[model samples]
Target: MHDEYNVQAGLNPRTVREYDEAITRVSLGYKSVDEYYSNSCSCHVVQHVRIPLLCIQAANDPIAPIEATPYSDIKDNPNCMLIVTPQGGHLGWVAGDDAPFGAPWTDNVVIEFLEHLQKNASKPESS
Candidate 1:
């Protein structure tokens, strides 16, 4: 993603000059590549997702690693659930392996959750 952004920025002459100036001013005497990479996680935003969330993570996803995802913090929420699978490969999990339209695991899980919500919603309310 970062590389793609860099390429796009380079293609724009104005952006290239702006970026070069900014980097020259900010980098100073920095030598290592680690200094330029951002290390912060968006856990603060995760803590604020008050809606009923069903996060499905592909166990082998390289971009969105299961271990780095903010599931643990929100897992205790009554309205939240995290389903981690061994396959899927990022957002590439297709359903029905050889079928025309893959049988995505997300489809079943989301449908079940919605059904559960509908069933519960139809229950009579107590006075």
Candidate 2:
């Protein structure tokens, strides 16, 4: 399933189960798999975004590997910020002593980042 569905594994032609293409086409209404990917992929889409965008990704994510990160584009785009954590699993970033009863560590990080943005939003720039 990973080989058939993962974007990283789409570089080569691999055998999918019978009716896989037909099922995908019917469900998604895409003429071909390549057409679907071309329209839906964010690798090139993020570069065109004009609003502030915060992207948090885990380096150890198995579903979406760290290698798939668009580092150069994020670096060049002022509106984009990518935070790659050394440790985290997909949407699970359990941390702190009270993690079992509290929110994930990412919640704090996101709140802090948003607070910072809000605080600086009204500040006048000095030329």
- Choose the strongest candidate by lDDT: 2
Give candidate 1 misplaced runs (Cα > 4 Å).
Answer: 1-5, 8-42, 97-100, 125-127
C-alpha lDDT score of every prediction, in listed order: 0.62, 0.71
- The TM-score obtained by model 1 is 0.59
Best by TM-score: 2
lDDT per residue for candidate 1 within 52-103, as digits (tens), equals 7778888888655666677767675666677888988868767665653766
| Overall local distance difference test of candidate 1 | 0.62
Each prediction's RMSD over C-alphas, in Å, is 8.5, 6.8
State the displacement of the C-alpha of residue 24, model 1, in Å, after optimal TM-score superposition. Answer: 20
